[model samples]
Target: MNFEIPPGLTDLLQEFTVAVLRTRPSNLEAFAADYFNNLNEKKNGPLKLSGALRFQENDTVNIIEPSDGHGSSNEDDDDDSFVGPPSSYRDRRKSVSAERYDPEADDEGDYTKVVNPKSDEQRRRLNDAIKHILLFRSLDHEQMQEVLDAMFEKIVDPGEEIIAQGDDGDNFYLIDDGKYDIYVNIDGKRKLVGNYNNEGFFGELALMYNMPRAATIIAASRGTIWGLDRQTFRRIVLKTAFNKRKKYEKLIEGVPMLSSLDMYERMNVCDALSSQTFRDGQQIIAQGDKADCMYFVEEGNARVAMVNKADPTATVEKEISRVGPGGYFGELALVTNKPRAASVYSVGVTKLAVLDVHAFERLMGPCMDIMKRNIGHYESQLLHIFGDKANISDLR
Candidate 1:
C-alpha cells in the first residue's frame, strides 16, 4: 500500500526518536515507516519506551518526568510506544501525541497511575524490599500505606541509568523486577561498587540529608522499580521515622550526660543509632583498645570488664557492671577517643541500640557538649580510682 507522509510528521517522529531513544536520529525513513505501520496496525503486546519522553533540558540538575504524562510500555521491541497510537497515522497525525494515555488502552498502567490494578503484588514486594532497611523499619502499616499512595512504578531497559551519580536526589527507588549495578566516582573515574536485584532498594542516603546521589545506579538488565518522590518521602517516611525515634529518646534521656539533650537533639541521636544483637560472650569492646561508641541495652543482659593490666594475661578482670535492660555503657571510651577502660561482652543473648561518637557528632555537632560532661567531670575521677573500670559504677 502506498503511504502519504504528512508535513512535519517526519520531524515529530524524529523529535520523539531523539528524546525517547536517547539516540541521534538515523534512518528517518525506516523509523517513520515502522512507526506509521505500528500506529495503523492493531498489535497486542507490551510496549517498551527507550527514554523519558519529556524531561527538563539544559538544566544544571537532572530532574526528569514523563513528558507524555506517561512512559512507554515495556514491549518485546524497545520502541517509544503507547496503546498502539490510534488505528491510523494518516487518519490522526495532528492528534496523535505522547502526552495522553487511555488506561483501557494502556496494557501496563503508565507513569501517572493513580490506582494500581496490581496493588496487592506491589504492596507485598514493596514492603518486603523495605523491611530490612533500618530507615523504614519504624513505619507502621498506615504510614506505609501513605507512602504507597505516593509511589509509582517504571521499567528501565538494560544499560539505562536508574539514578545517576552526583545528581540532586529527587526520588527513592525499590527494585521490583531486575538487577542494577551500583557505581560511585572513586578518585576521578566511576567505579563499580556493587549490584542489587529484586527486593533491593537505594536512594535513602540522599533523602536523609538532601545530599547529591553518592553513586550512580544503572540497570544491569531490563528492570522494574517502584519510586517515591522526595516530597512524599519527607512528608511520610521521614516524619514517621522521627516520630518513632522519639520513643527511644528516654534511653538517651536517662543517660546522665545525655539528659541535657533537647527533644530535637534526642531525635537526631535516635536517627544516628543502629540496633544490634550479640550472642552470649560476644566481645563488644576490647579493653585498652581504641574505642569510640556507646550502647543502650534494650534486651537481655551484658557484662562490662577491663583487662587485668597487673597480670597482662588474665582471663577476665572482675566484672565492672552487669548492664540489664535499659542500662547503657561505653560512654567513657567513646567520648574521650581513648583506649577502652573496660571490655564488654554479652552475658546471655543481648540486643542493644548503638551509636558511634562520629555518627553522633555528624548528626549533631554541638552534642559534643554532652560528651565533654561525660568524660571530663564524671569519668575523670573514676578513671583515677579504678584505673580501667569500663562502667560508671565506680563514680556511684
Candidate 2:
C-alpha cells in the first residue's frame, strides 16, 4: 500500500512535530489545539513562513528537535550560510538580536524565572564563556548575575547530538569543556562544516531570530556545556536595551544646547549615540585635528584644554574647563567646521556617549541654531586667552 502525503500537509505535520517535540506538553490534544491556532495566526500574519520564531510573552519550555529522519535538506542552501570565525561552528553570521525587539512586553512578571544553582568554579567558567557573547555583553552587573543564575549545565557524551539540524531553537549553548563536531545537510548529504573545542557558542542565531537550527552539533567527547533558556535570554536582552536607551535619552535631554529639540528629535539622537569609555589620562581629542564627532559625558569627567601652537618648540596645554556628567563638548568643531581649537582628555575613568558629525548634522538641525547663537560666547573665551593670536580658522 502506497500512502501519499500532500506537500501542504507535510509542511503542517513538520511544524506540528517540531513544536510537539520541543514543548512535550502533558496533554497532546490540548497542546495541538493551541499549537495550530498559534501557527495559523503566525502564517496568516504579515510575516511569511520561513526560518523565523516568535518569542511569546508567556512561554517556558526547553523543547529540542527530534531526529525523525525527515530533516530538511534545504537548510544550508543559502549563500554565506557556512561562513564562520575561528570558533564559529555553525551556519550564517547574522548580527545578534537583529530582529525587532519590543522590550515593553518582556517584563519579568510575564514568566517564571529559571534559577539553576552553580558552584563558584562553575559560575566563573560560565562567566568567562558568555562574557564575549554579544547577546550577553550588553547586560550589566545585576543582569549578568541574573543570567548566570538562570543557566543550567548539560553533560554531553561522545557522539551525542546536542542540536539537530532543522530543530526549533529553544536554548543558547556555550561550551565549558571538551569538543563538538558541526555538520550541515548539503544536497541530501550531511557535510562536516567545523568544530568547537573547549570554547565557543552555537544555537544563538536561531534563538535570537526565532529561526530553525542551521547546523547539527554532536559531542566528540564527554563535555559539560551551559544553556540559557530562550525566554530569559530574550527578556534580559530586550529589557537591557530599553533601559540603556532611556538612560541615554535622559542624558541627551539634559544638554542645554539640545533643549530646543522636540521629544521625537531627542529619541532620534538617542539612537544615533554610541557609548564609549576612557581610562584616566587618555587623550580623547587632540588639538588641531579634524573633529568628526562630539561627546556627551555620561559618567566621570573630561578635561577640555587649549594648546598653545604659537611656539612650536614649547608645546603646552592649559586646562580651560571640565565637562561633568550630563555635559557635552567637541561640538564647536562640528559647528565651525575647522580644526579642533582644544584637546579633550579623560579626567578619570570617563564614559561618553559619542555622536558623529554626520549624525549631528542630520539630527541636530534645531540645536544647531542654539549652538550658532552661542558662537560669540565661545569666541570671547578664545579671544580672552589667545589675544591677537586668536584665529577663528582654528575654531573655539
TM-score of each: 0.43, 0.52
lDDT of each: 0.56, 0.66
Which candidate leads the pack in lDDT? 2
TM accuracy, model 1? 0.43
- Write the residue-wise lDDT of candidate 1 on 237-334 in tens digits: 65555444545666666666566554434555665676788998999887777766778888899887654555455665666568888777776665
Error of 1 at 149 (Å): 17
Model 2 ranges with Cα > 4 A deviation: 1-102, 246-294, 298-303, 306-317, 321-351, 354-384, 387-396
Q: Write the per-residue lDDT of candidate 2 for residues 257-297, one digit (tens) a residue.
A: 77876544565566557688999999999988998999999
**Candidate 2 minimal-lDDT segment of 10 residues:** 1-10
Best by TM-score: 2
Model 1 RMSD in Å is: 18.9
* Angstrom error at residue 363, model 1: 3.8
Model 2: pairs clashing at backbone N, Cα or C within 3 Å: 22-63, 53-210, 81-92
Q: Backbone clashes in each candidate structure, one number apiece?
A: 7, 3
